[model samples]
Target: MFLLLVQAISLLLVPPLQSYHLDNAFGNPESVWNSLYYVVLLLLFTGAMLIIVRYKVNWLIQAIMAVAVLSTLVYVLFGLAVLLVPSVDPLIAGGVSVVLSLLLTALLIVYPEWYIIDTVGVLVAAGASALFGISLAILPTIVLLVILAVYDYISVYKTKHMLKLAEGFMDLKMPIMFVMPRRWGYSFMENNKGLPAEGAEREAYFMGLGDAVMPTMLAVSANAFLSAPPLLGFVNVPALGCILGTLVSYVVLMYIVVELKKPQAGLPFLCTGAIAGFLLGCLAAGVRPF
Candidate 1:
C-alpha cells in the first residue's frame, strides 16, 4: 500500500516534473538504445560495488552511500518544494531542501536506527521510483525491469554475490533496505549480525528498497506515457491495473516467502505482475502501452 500511494503521487508529479523538463530521462521516451545503456551502466556500477565489498573498502562504501542518499533526498525534496511552495523563490526552496537533505543524510549515516532507516528508505525509494518512471516510457521501463529481474535471479542463485552485497550493506548500516521487527525490542543497529541462514528464523524481516522501486516505475510509466482518461485523480486505467497487479503479486510473494523461507528474487514476480496487469489494462482501455 505504501508503494501504491507513492506511485500514485508520482503519477501526479509527472506534470510538475515536466514543467521542469524532468520527464524523459534521455529527452526521448521510447529509446531502446537508452534503455540498453542504462542496463550497461547498472552492470558497471554493480561490478564496482562488488570490488569495493571484496576489498572491504568500508569508508569508500559509506562515503558513496552518503552521496547517494543526499542526491536522492535532494531530487525528491527539490521537486516537492518547488511544487508545494510556488510562491517562494525556487532557489530558496531548493536551498532549503538541500540543507534538510544534508542533515537527514548525516543523521542516517551517524545513527542509522531502524526507525530512521525505514523513514529515509521510504522517501528515497519513492523518489527513485518516480524519477525513473517519468524518465522512461512504457517499453523502455519494461526492458529495464526485465533485465533487472533476470539479473537479480542470476546474482541470487547462480553467482550468489547479491547475498554478499546484502551482507556488506547491512554491516555498513545502510538504509537501502526496509527492516521490520518480528518481536518487540529488536535493535537493527546493534542486533543485526548479518543475513540469516536459509533455515534460520530472523528477528526482523528485510526487503530491499529496489524490490518496491522496480515495479513502481512501470506504474508510473503507464500513467505518464499513456493518455487514457484519468479515472481517479491522475490515475488512469492502465496505471491502476499495474498498481493492483503489483499488490496482488506482493501478497503472493509474501506467501512464497513464508512457505519457502529462503531468499527469493522479487523483481521476477513483481515485474511480471506489473507487465501482465498493464497489458490487460491496455486491452480493456483499447490503448497500447507502448
Candidate 2:
C-alpha cells in the first residue's frame, strides 16, 4: 500500500516538466528527438530489469532504482528552479543536482521495501510524463499514442516477448509497477520470482510504468498545446477535459481488467478517453479541428 502510494506520487512530476519545456522552447525536431529519447529510456529500463533478474544482483538493482528516483527529483527541482532562478544554470544546478541525486540514491540502497519502491516509482512516472508531454505536441502525442497502442497489442498478443520484460521486473521485485493484492496477507517479498497466485481468478494486479507514462504524455500535451479557458488554478479547458477523461477511462478499464479476468493494454483506453474529451471540450468552446 505504501509502495503504491509512492508510485502514484511519482506520477505527478510530469505536468511541471511539460509546462517548463513548452514555455521555454518549441520545435518539431525537438519533439522528434524527445520521442526517440523515450524509446531509449524504455529499452534501458528493460535491459536493467533483465540484468537484475539474470544476475540476482540486488545491489545493482538498488543502485539503478536510486538513480531513477533521484533523477525524478532532479526533474522536479529543475522545473521549480525555472520559476525561481533569474537565469537558468544547467551547470551550477548540476552540482546541487548531483548532491540531491546521491542522497536519494543512498537512501534507496540502505532500505528498499515496498514503500520506498512505490514512492520512487511514482516520482519516476511523473517526471517521465512531464518531460515527454513538454517535448511532444498534440499531433506527435497522438501519433505516439497510436503507434504504441498497436505495438502493445502486437507485443502482448502476437509476439508474447513483452511478457519477458514483465517477468523480469516481477522477478526483481522492482517498484516500477503498481501492485494490487487480492488478499490481505499477500506479500511482495515472499514471491521474488513473479506475482504470487492468490486464487482461481487472480492473485495480484500489476501495471507497468509505461501504462502511466504513455497516457500522461497525451494529458500533458493536451494541456500544453490546446488552447483552453482556465478552469482551476492555471489549468485550462482542454487540459482539464483530458485529465477527467483519462480518469474516467482508467476507472472503466480497471473494472474490465478486474471483472473480465483479462489483461488489457492501458494506453488504448486512456488515450482514447483523453483525446475524445479534449475534442469534445474544443467543440464546446467552438474551436475547429485542426
Candidate 3:
C-alpha cells in the first residue's frame, strides 16, 4: 500500500513537474546517452559503496546518503511549493523548500526512526520518480528499465554485492529502504541487530526505494510521451495500463518473496509487466507503442 501511494503521489506531481517545464538533465530524453550516463553512475556508486563497507567506513556512507536525501527532498518540496501556490516567487518557494527539507533531513539524521524515515522517504521517492519519469522519454525509459533489471539480477545473484550493500545499509539504519513492522511496537531505531538471517522470517518487511521508483518511471513516461488519448484526466490509456500491470506484478512478486520465501530480483518482473501492459494498452487504444 505504501509503495502504491508513492507512485500515485508521483503521478499526481507529474502535471506540476511538467508545468514547470522540467527537462531531462541530458538534453534529449530519447537519446541512449542518458541511459548510459545513468548506468555508469550506478556502477560507480555501487563500487564506492562496496569499498566503503569493506573498509568499515560506514559513517561515511551515512553522511553521503544524508546529503543525497537532503538534495532530493529539496527538489520535491520546491516543486510542490510552487505547485500549490502558482503566484509564489521561485526564490521564495526555493527558500521555503530548503528550510523544510533541512528540517526533515535533520529529523532523519537525529531520530532515525521508522516512521520518520518513511515520511521523508515517501517525499524523496515520489519526487525522484516523477523527475526521472518526465525527464526520460518512453523508449529511453524502457531501455533503462531493461538494463537495470539485468544489472539487478547480476548484482544480487552473481556478484552478491547487492546483498552486502543491503547489510551495510541495514547497519546504518538510514532512510534508503522502506520499513514496515509485521508486529506492533517494532522499532527500527533499536532493531540494531542487523538484517534477519537468510530465510529467517523478519520482524519487519523491507522494500528497496528503487523498487517503487523504477516501475513508476514507465507509467510517467507513457503518460508524457504516448499519443494515446487521456483515459482519465492527465493519465493516458497506456500509462493507466502500466499502473494496473505494475500493481498486479507487485502482488505476484510479494507473494513469491513474502509468502513463499523465495527471493528474486523485483525489477525484472515489474519492468516486464509494465512494458507488456504498456504495449498492450497502446495497441488496444489504437496507438503506437514506441
Candidate 4:
C-alpha cells in the first residue's frame, strides 16, 4: 500500500511539476554532464549523511532534511495550486505553498507520529522523483538509475554503510524512511530499537524514501520525454509500462522481505524492472529505446 501510494502520487504530480519546469541542478537534461553531475551530487550526499551520523549530529541532519522536504513540497504544492486555479497569481500560489509546507514541517517536528511521517514521506518522495524526472532526459535518467542501483547494492551488501545511515535516520524519526507497521498498534516513536533480525517476523516493514523515489523517476522521465499517446490521462504508454514494472518489482521485493524474510536492496530490483519495462514500452510505442 505504501509503495503504490507513493507511485500513484508521483505519477499524478509529474505533469503539473513539468508545467512548472522544476528540474534540479542540471539544466540540460540531454547532456552527459548532467548524469555525471547528479552522480557526483549523490556521492556527496551519501558521504555527508555518513559523516553526520558518525558525529551523532542527528538534529542537524534532521534540520537539513526538513528544509529540503519543505522546499520540494513548496514546489509541488505551488505547481498543483496553479493547475487547479489556472489564473491564480504566482504570489498567491507561493504563499499557499509556503504555508502548507511550514505546517507539514511543524507537524513532523512536533508529533513525529508514524502516520504523519509516512504521509509526509510519500509527499516528499513524489515531489523529489518528479523533480529529478523532469531534470534528466531518457539516457541520463537511465544512467542515473543504473548507477544508483549499483551504488545501492554496494552500500547495502558490500559496505553496509547504508544500513548504518538508516539506523541513524530512524532514530531521528524524520521522514527519511517510510514506516509500514504490520499491526495498527505499532508506534514508530516507541519502537526505535533498530531493524529486526534477519528472518524475523517484524512488527513493521521499512523502506527508504529512495527506494520509492528512484523507480518513479523513470516513470516521470518517460511521461515527460516520450512521444507516445497517453494511455492513462497523466502518462504515455512507456511511462505506464514503467509504473507497472515498478509495481511488479515491488511485489517481488516484498516477497523477499515477507516470504524469504530478508533485508534486500530495493533499487536493484526496481531499476532493473523499470528499465526492462521501459524498453519494452518503447518497442511497443515504436520509439527508439536509447
Predicted candidate 2, C-alpha RMSD: 4.7
Candidate 3: minimum summed lDDT over ten consecutive residues — where? 256-265
**TM-score for each candidate, following the candidate numbering:** 0.95, 0.75, 0.94, 0.95
Error of 3 at 121 (Å): 1.6
Candidate 1 deviant stretches above 4 angstroms: none
lDDT by candidate, in order shown = 0.83, 0.62, 0.83, 0.83
Residue 210 error, candidate 2, Å: 1.1
Q: Tens digit of lDDT per residue, candidate 3, span 71-156?
A: 98988888788778989998899899999999998889888888887888789988988999989998888899999999989987
Q: What lDDT, from 0 to 1, does candidate 2 have?
A: 0.62
Q: Rate residue 23 of model 3 by lDDT.
A: 55
Residue 56 displacement (Å), model 1:
0.7
Better of 1 and 4 by lDDT: 4
Per-residue lDDT, model 2, residue 243, is: 66
Q: How well is each residue in 1-290 modelled by candidate 4, as lDDT tens digits? A: 77777777777777666666566547788886787788898889989999999999978898898898899889877877877887898899999999999999889888888899888888888888878888888998898889989999999999999998888887777748888888978888887677778887788888999998888888888888778878757778888788888889888898888987767899999999998888888888898756
> How far off is residue 139 in model 4, in Å?
0.5
Residue 167 lDDT, candidate 1, scale 0-100 = 90
